[model samples]
Target chain A: MTIAMTTSPEALTACCTPTGEPAMSEETASSLAAQFKAIADPNRLRMVSIISSSENAEACVCDITEPLNLGQSTVSHHLKILVDAGVLTREKRGVWAYYSLVPGALDSLAGALTGRS
Target chain B: MTIAMTTSPEALTACCTPTGEPAMSEETASSLAAQFKAIADPNRLRMVSIISSSENAEACVCDITEPLNLGQSTVSHHLKILVDAGVLTREKRGVWAYYSLVPGALDSLAGALTGRS
Candidate 1:
């Protein structure tokens, strides 16, 4: 529910600058932190991996919950966190919500790790 | 005191895998989380910025504390965390300890964020 559209790499770059730079602006820190917070938890991190490695780099909540050995609602909550972080994309298909990687979102974050991007 | 030698990028790369590929191994998660946890604090994040943007990509604790408006002990603690996380390198110079960016540590973390190495 607290998600916004991070529609481009520039937006992500602008919002999530290098720590080697001037740290990051407060808003940028908060936004980038939100994305990191999504993965801060071990459960959510695992969920992201499972979801990404799924068929076509995406998976539905139903498929995600099984390998996780967690409750359905718990899986849904984690999925929402990833979607909100701009790390994953979610689409509604008939009666299910399908989730996939946000193309370069992870790559952008990876770029921060490499100091490029 | 809880830190170990993270001497190379291969170590960093092998240690910190892509979150999307799979949740990082537990050991990798703990190590990478230690780095993120270092920056999780607002004060530390700010301090890192000031230190990183300083001359020579490094700064002494003496220069770092003033701009932060924080206690000297607090600054020292944060510096230790960054050093331990492998994000910043430390060297003893006479009576002072000089800290500098650990080359690609942040880049590696940024890699995690962007989903690359």
Candidate 2:
């Protein structure tokens, strides 16, 4: 998946350098772009909002599909894209999968964008 | 163009409520996605980094194209997208257009993503 091409969470976390601080290396820009691309879709952004605001900041696919008005398969696809980008983590609970925001992932991206590190 | 559909900077600034705080409304999600879509390209992200790190936190298109290895037209297109998204402000200086990061724009986006007010 495209996730393999993204910067590791460790690299991303350490990369709190703001856009105003320095010129971004091609590698860093590519990695950041991959993460942004994950959330660039309207459906995925809504899914992130819904999943993030859910109980424990996590939710099952069933919990999101209805509010998003997207079918289960579509929601699942978006979830996979997010997960692959390291923005969300997936855990297996019997027959269903639960997804939760990865701690610090969003913060790292924010820091990079805002130069708030 | 598409910028007309985006949420106003005022709305985005007041939207530091964070993703975990509540489910984002469709209007909010769409606006955020439009902003993300603007920077989702690697070339654009690099251009932003270069421009933001330049003198006075701004740069002329000529200053960025060579480092970015992109033609002036391509660089201008990306800059226009960012300006339209309100992430960057454009000013005419003589015959050159200077682009600078809009104050607090990235911070607002970061705040929304990271749930930091």
Candidate 3:
């Protein structure tokens, strides 16, 4: 595989320096883009800040709506996006559902942005 | 201000625990969301990977289009978005423009996401 790659004329291109950094695949880009898109909204980011900074880095949907002055349904929509993106996890306790950071999600994304990945 | 905050019942809310983490403001969220939104597309992300992994973490408009099989105009559009968001900066020399990450831009965004900011 290395021999085959080294033979390609593209190997000589500036994009393919021997930095051991492979260009991101379309798949990787799509997945990461989805995560980034999920948090690309201002209100959604506020939701993340509120939840991540909450006690135990988690909070209930009911408690989340008021501080941000958002309605229940709107907060839920943002929370759902974060959960789907793997940035947050949800747990149900009796009548209330709580949300918290998925742990290291942002750090990994940070690594990707700086090419540390 | 400290006394005023201590007396508010909302301060007692779980969203406002004593962790010293302030929820992201509308302005901060809007600015960050723009940066995140710029990179939220797959093609844009691939462009970022190609440039970031390049030698010295920078690349030219000419060299960038080929790796992703994108036309000049599309790549230019993506580059403009990145530049406008302050994630990447563009410098023109002679006939070519080179782009590089705004130093610590992604790190700071990462910090914002993890509430480290």
What DockQ do you compute for every candidate structure? Answer: 0.14, 0.23, 0.33
lDDT tens digits, residue span A1-117, model 3: 355453366643534334455669999999999999999999999888877767788888866777779889999988999999999999975456889888888877877876565
Ten-residue region with minimum lDDT total, candidate 3 chain A: A11-20
TM-score of chain B of 3: 0.78
Tens digit per residue, CA lDDT, model 1, B10-39: 434342233344444556656666677666
| lDDT, candidates in the order shown | 0.66, 0.79, 0.80
Candidate number that wins on lDDT, 1 or 2: 2
TM-score, one value per model: 0.66, 0.79, 0.81
In the range A1-117, model 1's lDDT, one tens digit per residue, is 855444554433342223344444666556655666667666666666676666577776756665556898988888887788798888975456778888877776554334354
Poorest 10 consecutive residues of model 3 chain B by lDDT?
B11-20
For candidate 3, the per-residue lDDT at B53 reads 76
lDDT of 3 at B46: 87
Give me the runs in candidate 2 sitting further than 4 Å from their true place.
A1-22, B1-22
TM-score (C-alpha) between model 1 and the true structure: 0.66
Look at candidate 3 and tell me the lDDT of residue B40.
Answer: 94
